[model samples]
Target: MKEDMYSIKMRAVRKEKHISGAERIISEKEIEVLVQQLTARALGHSKGKPDFINITIQNIGNQAIEYIAPLNIATITVDDYFKGRECAIKALQKSGLSCKTSQAILNMLKTCNTMRGAILLDIHSLERLEPDENRGVRVTNIDWSFKIKEDLEKALEKKGLNNNHVKEAVALASKVSNAPGIVAELCWSDDPDYTAGYVASKDVGYMRITKLKPLGDSTGGRVFCFDSSKTSIEECIEYLQKKVTLIHKIPMIKD
Candidate 1:
C-alpha cells in the first residue's frame, strides 16, 4: 500500500465594473472570516487523502460584472486533484454539500476579495471571523406588504411560478423585512444606483440585505434575502427557517 497526496493551485479572476449605482463594495473582513470559517468546517476535512490546494487571484481583465448575476451564479474551476471521486469530495457529498459549498466558496471569492487581492492558500487558510466592527445595518421592523406580493405574482406569472414558489418569494420578502442582517437604508448619494432585489454583497462575502423596499421596483426596490453561509442544499432550504431565529448582535444596528 502507498500513501499519496496531491498538491494543487488555482487561479481566480476578478473583474470590476464601476456601474452607475452598482459599484463594487467590500464589507468588513471579519464577516468574511466568519463565513470562511464556517465553510472550512463543512468542507475542509472529511475522508480524504492528504490534499493541498493553493488558490490565487487574477485581475488581468477589466470586464464589468452585472450586479444581479453573482446571486444566481455558481461555477468552480478545480485542479486535477478533485477527481470527483476523491475522499474529501465523497465526504462532502455525504455531508450533502455536493457543489453548493464549492459555489458559495467561489461566489465568496468573487465578491469578498479586493478588486485586486489574493486569497491563494492551502488548508492552513481556513477562514476566520474577527471581533465586532459596528458596521452592520440598522433597520426598523415592519411587517411585509401583501399588495406588493400580489403585484410580484402577477408580473412574473409567465415565468411559471406556482403557489409554493409564490410563497417562497413572498416569504423571502417578509424575511428580509424582519431579518437581522438587513436594514432599510436610503442611498445618501444625490443620484444613487441601487439594486432592487436580493443579491450577494461584497460585504463579508454573504448574501445580505442590500436594498429593501417592498412594492417598489422588481429590480431595485426592496426584497433581498439569501443565506450565503449555507453549504448544502438542505442548509439553503433551511435558511428560511433560520431567519425566524435571526438576532442582531453587532451592537451597532438600531432597532
Candidate 2:
C-alpha cells in the first residue's frame, strides 16, 4: 500500500508567549507517535511548563488534518545554555567584527522582543538592509524538499551530529554568507526553551553559541551582515529572497 505524507507543526506557549516549536514531515502511520514525542519534548522544556500547546497536522496540499489541545508536560537542561553576556561579546570580536558592529548587532537583538522574521543589516553602516516600519525580512515558503537539505543532513550525520534545527540554520546561513558582499550571520531562536544560537561565515563555518538569550526569554532573530562595497543592496537582497539557494558544503568549526 502507498503511504501518504503529513506535516506536523507544534508550538508551546506560556502566558500567551511562544516558548517552543517543532516541525516534521512524516508518513501517516507515524503521525501519532511523532505528535506524542513532540508534545512530551515541549512540556519537558527547561523554560518551564507551557500554559498551552498548539499542534496542527496537515497534508502535503496544506489541508489541515487535526488540531491538538493545550497540554502541559517536563524539562531538560542544555549543556552550557547560559554562557554570560561577555562570552557573546567575545565571540563576535573573535569573528572579526568591529566593536561598533558587535554592539549594533546586540542592540538589534534587544529589539526583537516579539516574533519577526530575519533581518539583514549592513555591517559598515549598521542599518537595516531592507527598511520597514514593523517587520524584518520574512524568510518563508522555503522548498525544504531540495537536495541541498538532504546533502547537508548526510554531512552532519557523518559528523555524529543530528540536530534538525542546527542543520536548517546552517543551510540558511551558508546560503546567506555565500552571497556577494555578505560577511557573516548570527541567529538565535525566539523559542524561550532553546537558548543555543550560531554565528556563521564563509571563512569559518557554523560556530554554536551556547547562550544567545536568557531562558524564558522569547526575543530572538537572525542578522545577516553584509559589506555594501562588494555587492549592491538590491543584488544582495535579491539573492536572499530566492527560494532555492544552493551551497557546495558548509565547513563546520571545531573546538
Provide C-alpha RMSD values for all models, in order.
23.3, 8.9
Q: Write the residue-wise lDDT of candidate 1 on 50-148 in tens digits.
A: 233223222212222111111111112223322311322233233233355433333332233112112211111223211221211211111122224
Model 2 lDDT-worst window of ten = 67-76
Q: Estimate the TM-score of every prediction.
A: 0.20, 0.62
Give the number of the best model, judged by lDDT: 2
The per-prediction tally of clashing pairs is 10, 3
lDDT of each: 0.25, 0.63
Poorest stretch of ten by lDDT in candidate 1: 17-26
